[model samples]
Target: MENRKAIEAGQDITMQKEDFAALWKTIHLKVTDTYEVPPEILWVNGSTIGTLGNFSASTGKAKSKKTFNISAIVAAALKNDEVLKYSAYLPPNKRKILYVDTEQSKYHCHKVMERILRLAGLPTDKDRDDFVFIVLREQTPDKRKQIIGYMLENMPDVGLLIIDGIRDLMYDINSPSESTDLINLLMRWSSGYNLHIHTVLHLNKGDDNTRGHIGTELNNKAETVLQITKSQQDGNISEVKAMHIRDREFDPFAFRINDNALPEIVDGYVFQQPKQDRNFPLTELTEQQHRKALENGFGKQVVQGYSNVIAALKQGYASIGYERGRNVLVSLNKFLVNKRMIVKEGKGYRYNPDFHY
Candidate 1:
C-alpha cells in the first residue's frame, strides 16, 4: 500500500497540466536580461527597427539592388563609431553583430568590407576583429537546425542576426505554409533568444512575392519590409524603399545607393525628380519600348474573361467556362504579371505605362 501510494503521487506530478502550461507560457514570453529596447542601428533614419522576434525578409528583382548590402552599412557604422553619434546623440556602444552569410563567401564579404571601410574612412583592419562571419552554403533542414542551435548556444551576445538569402536555408519558397513553418522556427529562435533577425530573399522575377510559401509568410510577418529596386536613371544605382509593412509603428521612406566604391545612405534624394538623359535613350530604348507599348495596348483592351476575377490575383482566374485565362495571360504577358504593377483592391488591374513604357 505504501509503495502504491508513492507511485500514484509520482504519476500525479507528471500529469500536472497547469505546471506544463506555465512552463510553456514562460518560454513563449522569453525576455532578455536587459529590459531596455535594444538599439538596432538602422540603415535609414526614422526607420522602424523591425521586430527581432520574427524573420524580416527583403526581396527584390534580379539585378536589382541587394537588401543584404545593408549589412555593409552596419559594418560601416561599427567601423566609424562617430557616425553613430549623429543618429543617436549618445556615443555608440560597440556591440557584437553576428552575420550568417548563407549566400556569399568570406572572400566576397571581405571585398565588400574593404569598399565600405574605405568609403567610411575607417580602419579596414579593425573589421576583422569587430565582426563575426559564419558562411554556410545551401544547407539541408537538419543542417540548418544544427547550425542555428550552435549559433544560439555559442553566440548569445549577438545583437544583430543577418541571414543572407533565406532561400539558401530552405528547400522551397513557393510553399507559404512550409515557409511559414520555417520562418516560425527562426522567429521562435530569435524571440526565444531575444535577437534582431534580418533575412535576405530574392523577389520572384516579375512579382514582389519571394520564391516560395514561406517567402510570402516571412514578408508578411516581418516587422518591416524593404524592397530594393534598380534606379531607372542609372542602372548602377539601386534604390532602397522601406516600410513598416507589417508593424503599425513604422513609417515608410526611400533612399538610393550612390556610385561610390562603398555605398552609404545619402540625402534622401527623390529619384522621381526630372533629370537630364545623360545617355542616349533612343538606342537603348528601341526594342524594350516597342515590346512594352504593344503589351500596354493589349492589357488596356480589357481582359474579357477575367471580368469577375479577384483584382489582386494576377493568375489562376477562372470564368466558369473560360479554362484558358492563365494560358492567355501567360502568352500575352498582359493578364499575368510581367512585372509588379499598380492595381487597386477591386479594380481588377491597371497597366502602369511608366513601368512598361
Candidate 2:
C-alpha cells in the first residue's frame, strides 16, 4: 500500500518493499549469497569521501559557514564536476540530488538554492529538474520526517540527499532511544534506496564534540564525520578535518567565503600538526603493517575494553621489537577503529579480517 502511494505519485514500483525482513533473514548471511557494494559518489585525491548506501555527517559551531561547504558539495554532484578538489561521479540512473532544509525559512532556502545554482554554473533564476530543494521549518518534527519519507519514495532516481539540521527531526536530541532510532532510520534509508545521505549537525557550546547523544551515535556509526572548525591560525578562515572516516584520511583543508558568496579553497595554509607524546621507534604503519599488527594483536579473538586493546597491541608491537606506549596505543586504537579495521562489539573490539587493504 505504501508502494501503491509511491506509484500513484509517479515512482517506479520496482523500488517498493513491503517491509524489510522483520524476522529471521535479518541475521542471515550466506557465503553463497552475493552482496553488491555501492558505487563511490565523492572523492578527494583519489581516496573515497562518500559512497552510496551510507551516510556522512559534518558538524560545526554557530556561524561556521556550514552551508557554504555544503553548497560546494551540492554543486559538485549537480555538475558531476570538481569543486575545491572534490570530484563526483554518479551513475546515469541515479543523477538527481535532493536538499532538505529543516531549520531555514523559505527566504533563506531560496538564497541557498541560488548559491548552489551559481556555484554549479547554472542559471540562478530558474530551477533545474535534477536539483530539488525544500524547506521544512514550518512543519512539525514528525511531519518533517514524514515528508522526507514521501520524497524518498516518490522522487525518482535521487542519488544524493542532504538533510540540513537533522536535529529538527526529533523532539529531543539527548534522548538515547530517539537518537538510536534516528540513526537506524538513516542507515535503512541509505541502504534501501541505494543513495548517499549527508547530514549537518552543530557542536556543543564551549566544547569541540557534537551535541548530545545523537552526536555520540553519529560519531560511532557515520561512514565519515567531518568537523568544520575556525582555523586556529586565522579565525577568518574555516577548516575541514576528518574527525573519523572509514577510509584513509585526507589532508585537512580550509576555505573562505569569497565576495561572490561562494566558497574558495585557501591554499598554502600551514596547518599545525598535533604535538607528539612519548617517542616510539615507529610511529606510523603501512597498510600491510597494520594488517600484520592486527593478526598479531587479535590472533582470531576479541579483545575486551580499552585496556585490553592497548595491552594486546603492546604485545603485538613487542613481537616486532617496537616500543608501544600509552600515547601510541591510544592513537593506534583510534586510527584502527576509524578505518574499521578494528570494529567495536558491545564493550569490546575485535579485528575484522575483512578490512580492505
Candidate 3:
C-alpha cells in the first residue's frame, strides 16, 4: 500500500496545456504535408455537402425506403468512379465491405447486393471474397473484438462497416451506461481510422423513437439520418427520406425503392378529377366515363406512399421539408400533375375554378 501510494503520487497522468498544444501542432504538421485523411463517401450524389459529414437517425414508422436509397448510393459510390467527378461521392470500389448481419438472412442480403451492384453496373464477382459477413449466431464480446481487430489489421483498407441491427451487436442494449461506452469506443476507432459505419436500428412500437440507449447515441453521432416507409398499395415498394438531421447546414431529400436498382426519386403526386361538359349527355356516365369525360378524376387510393406524397406537400408551398407546418412540395411531371379545374401558380397548383370543393 505504501509503495502504491508513492507510485501514484509520482505518476504524471495530468498534462499541461502547453504539452497538448505541442502535440496538436506536431500532429497537424504530419497530417498537413504527408498523411491523407479520406473523406466520408457520400451515398447520394451532391448530397454529401447537403447531408453534412455524417448521416445517422431513426426512420418513421413503416419507412425503409430511405435506407434502400442510401445503400444504393453507397454502392454506386463504391463501384462507379465517374460519379465522383460531379458529386462528392465515394464508391468503395475494390475496397472490401464489412457486413455484420445480426437479423438479416444470407439470402435476403444477397438479393439486395445483387440488385444494387447490377444497378451500379458491376460485373459478376465472388461474393465470399468481395464482402465479409459477420453473422451473430453466437457472437461473444471477445469474439467481436477478435473479429474487428483482425479485420482492421488484415484488411485495414475496408471502406464500409454495415451492422444490420445495433441491438444484436451488443450484449446489453438497454443499459445506457454500457451503450455510452460502446458508442465512444466505436467513435474513437472510426475517427482514428476514418471508416464509414452504417447500421440498422429498430424503432419503438407505434413511436418514432429508436430502440434502446445505444440507438440514441448512434443517432446523435451519425453523420446521416434516414427514414424508410413502404407503399400502402403493396408494401413491396418503399420510400426513403434522407436528412442531415444531425448537421444543421444540410437539406433532406426523398427516394423511392427500386425492385432491381437503388431507389430513385419518384417525381411527385397529382390530384385530378373528371372533366364535365354541358354538351355531353346529362345522364351520369359509368365510372370509366366519369373518370375520362370529366376533367376531374376520382381520388385514387394512395397505393403505397400516396398519402406521404400528400403529406409531403400539405403545406401548399413549393419548397423542401416542413416549414411552419408547410410540408415539402414535389411537382409531378407535366403528364402527371393534377390539372382538373385547379388553380396554378408558379408550380403551386390548386383546384381549378370550375371544380366544386
TM, every model? 0.61, 0.77, 0.56
* Deviation in Å, model 3, residue 81 alpha carbon: 5.6
Q: Can you tell me which runs of candidate 3 are displaced by over 4 Å? A: 1-40, 43-45, 49-67, 81-88, 91-94, 125-130, 231-237, 243-264, 269-357
Record all residue pairs in model 1 with backbone atoms less than 3 Å apart, i.e. clashing: 173-211, 173-212, 173-213, 174-212, 174-213, 175-213, 176-213, 179-214
Compute the lDDT for candidate 2: 0.84
Q: Encode model 2's per-residue lDDT on 1-357: one tens digit a residue.
A: 998887787754334354435543776788898977779998866678789999999899998888888888888999998887678987898899999999989998999999988988899777688999989999999999899889999976999999999999999998888988999999988988889999999999887768888887787788888888888788778988887777888888899888988889998988887665546523465676777777897888889978999998888766766657788888767667656677765457788777754
Which residue pairs clash within candidate 2? none
Top TM-score hit: 2
Write model 3 residue lDDT over 21-47, tens digit each, in one string.
987874665434764444645434444
| Steric clashes per prediction | 8, 0, 39
How good is model 1 by TM-score?
Answer: 0.61
Alpha carbon lDDT of each predicted model: 0.53, 0.84, 0.49
Off by over 4 Å in 2: 1-27, 279-357
After aligning candidate 2 to the native by TM-score, how far in Å is the CA of 247 from where it should be?
1.9
lDDT of 1 by residue, 1-357 (tens): 999999999987784778788888665654554465644444345444443444465667886757335545455445534232112111233345666767666788676556645644667666454457677765675586679668777766665667776776766666546666677777787787666677777777865555656654664466666677777766766666552243233333334445655454545545674332333232243434434543533455334334433331223222211223333434334322323232221223444444422
Question: After superposition, which runs of candidate 1 have C-alpha atoms over 4 Å from their true positions?
Answer: 1-19, 22-24, 27-43, 51-54, 76-94, 116-121, 126-129, 243-260, 265-268, 273-357
Deviation of model 2 at 102, angstroms: 1.1
